[model samples]
Target: MSKNVDYMVAIPARYASTRLAGKPLADVGGAPMIVRVCQKALESSASEVVACVDHELVAQALEPLSRQDSRLTVCMTSQNPRSGTERIAEMLRIRNIDPQTIVVNVQGDEPLITRDHIDEVAALLASSGAQMSTLCNPISSIDDVFDPNCVKVVMDKDNFALYFSRTPIPYERDNFAQGQQAVTELKFKHYHHIGIYGYRAATILDYLQKEPAAIEVAESLEQLRLLHYGMKIAVATTERPPETGVDTAADLERVNRIFASQGK
Candidate 1:
């Protein structure tokens, strides 16, 4: 990957989450979760890092960090963006960022997200010249393959995504018939899709304008919309899996324990 490729890290932080209310403001270590997420983004090779938030309190929470780092900024976005990608699209327009600029969408709740993975996705998009890029990790457990919460992705030989679904793809029919344990003894590797994404500002805008695909609506996966429009999404495998993101109270507790152990 070229060292000179300029990219921006944009995080979408919405205050109201059904599972974990005020998720962005949740305390992790000594700082708010959103602030911790911003710190991670700042550690990346991106030229700029902006947290796109829905609530004023979320922006206020990021004030100290944004003031300390020139590269960090906060943008208050619409409260009702259908998804994080849409919020980022709104932010791009609000900030008047150059359409050609590359932007990486990092979830605000993932405080443990590493700079290496962030940079990897951005570098893949920059070097591959694909419409978008993302990372995935090999599924080591059989439970994750059947778990609807864990989205699965199948890639072509070129490492471009062929399909993404909640249910397993390229189903090992013979192995599955032997039951769950047999499925684990796979002939090919199954992959869990990481949510992070890299795309040009213009690509995001164009994506928003396209009609949502039926498969996207059915599976509740936004990336499918891009595929419906014939966009290429390059995928890379990551050896190091990211720490869990805070989604529920239990997840928050788990992440906090991890932070405490790290002496954060």
Candidate 2:
């Protein structure tokens, strides 16, 4: 399991959410969502999982969880980061983390992230030796494949991503006219982006310093900035799509339902 390698998972959480303020500390089932996230990361083969949050209220919310389990480490980061990349960069610098160690940034809102998912990503990053790595799951359903909210990724033969977009890519001009079967056959390997990311400590810092790229601003995907700067992102394919994180009130309600059903 590569226990010898030092790896850490840091969830970059913010208190402000345009859809739901104090989103990080929002309760899911019997636990705050962030606590669930931290628990999953700690379950991985990583050395540690920390919450690098901006607000004191968030810290306070996480405090009870930390007391309940001492494995969770709570740290402070700047509220000024323009992007998640910047926040991770700042956390790496503050901790004086080894540049060669692998750091996984599991989105704070994804309470359903599994321990296996975290470990699988870490293994892919180490095996591929790429600057960065992320997960993608094939879309068999026609609705999800065409859904813009399900960000699609086109990868090369080596599994290095060529581009990512909210648009349905590799457009089969004839398929839409033909109906479901035609669309499904055409998109046999269509993949949806999972927000999970792994980076070499140095690569992350380098990405933060580069100016935002043309595609980055247009697509609103920060990972595009790495591609613009000519960074190689290796992909690991998972068996199924992960549960969506809390974004809107509807998303929260959906997640709550899932958690409640599971008796979590």
Candidate 3:
């Protein structure tokens, strides 16, 4: 494995989430969720870690963490951007980041992101030679497979993503009328899409500039924009499923429990 690559983990921390307002700055243990995400990425062998926040209050909350670690670069992006990808693009443009830089988009809500998952997604992009890369863990249980909240991904034989849907895809005909319990015995395979992504600096810029595709609007999936433009997305299978991301108060409690279990 080549460790010399100049990969930068950019965590896009938006403070305006409707589900949990000021979510990125929400307290987890003592430190904020965004800081936890940045620190997790910093654990990886990436060259740099940055928090691309849209609000000044978020930047203020991140200030102390910036002082603690020189690796934490705080960047202010547009507060009105349509998506996380747009915010990252704006930050790259303002900073005049090198086009050669390999940037990874890490969601701020994911406080428990692991280095192994980061390295796995990054390595997939490097080895597959694809413009963009993301990860998904196979769904073993029926509960997660049927939940609409759990976005499912179907991939080609080569592991390139064919489509992403909120609906339970490859719908087992035998289990359609029966329900999740009966589907488990049908020898079916499903996958849940992970929120992390790895892409080149230039590829992201190009993607943001393009118009939103029809499928993207219907499904509310940003990855569809890449696929709509006919860009091949390589899917790397993660050994471990992702930890809970803090989208609501209940989610925060779940993350806190995970941290307590680890004695953090």
Candidate 4:
């Protein structure tokens, strides 16, 4: 709703995938997954959609489409960055993007990244004056609460994140025994950490300046580093369900099936 909010969407698609090699080019329904992500960003309110990739193959794949859409670009970056945020930072530098530029990070693997959340995050950052903003969804399944890969987050009454972790947060010490009811009860307080993020290009660059915190390395959650440095992260809760990002073969098949069923 904040049309005055200036923002760009960048997808950091690293070719090195520990689980699925060349994940950016992985097929979803009919086209490459990164292409789907790019298309989604293109549909958003952002002024530009840049695909910051690591390999030539990713650049080559995105180049043809970028030529057709001026809003899209393909920039190859060094593969050695610690995380995708670092990769996006490199893109910002290479593109000479202003430090105050608001850039939304739409993960290359999340073809189904929420457009509403993208706008919400950018608006939240602009309105709340937080260094960064991200979206979270209520945990509906017990499987996800205990799933280490599915990071969880707890936010204060002011809607700023208190912490992010793999373990179930705000753990009810006197909750009901395990069952479908308990899962539903946990949903009342627990939230799934959506991987999508929005921040000023300067904010992320400043973040990289800090040394890795013990908590960050311990939890393997990069956002912890920001919180560890006392950066306030605004969180927007959404009813929209979290999409399964492609990582393994099972994940690929699952996303493909979802897209195929939707007649994409």
What ranges in model 1 sit over 4 Å off? Answer: 178-184
TM-score of each: 0.97, 0.92, 0.94, 0.93
lDDT of each: 0.91, 0.83, 0.85, 0.86
Task: Write model 2 residue lDDT over 55-160, tens digit each, in one string.
Answer: 8888888888788767688889987976666777888889998999899889889998987788877877888878889999887777777787889998999999
lDDT of 4 by residue, 1-264 (tens): 657788999899988899999899998888888898898888778888889898888888777778889999888899778679899999988989999999889889998876677788789889988888998888877777778888999999999999999976776655534643555455356899888888998899899999999999999999999999999999999888657788899999999888888899
What's the distance in Å from true for residue 74, model 2? 1.0
Which pairs in model 3 have colliding backbones?
Answer: none
Pairwise lDDT winner, candidates 1 and 2: 1
Q: What is the C-alpha RMSD of each candidate to the true structure, in Å?
A: 1.3, 2.2, 1.7, 2.2
- Please tell me which model should have the higher lDDT, number 3 or number 4: 4
TM-score of 4: 0.93
Better of 2 and 4 by lDDT: 4
Q: Better model by TM-score, 1 or 2?
A: 1
Clashing pairs in 1: none
Worst 10 contiguous positions by lDDT, candidate 4: 179-188
Q: Highest TM-score: which candidate?
A: 1
The top-ranked prediction according to lDDT is 1
Q: What is the alpha-carbon lDDT for the whole of candidate 4? A: 0.86
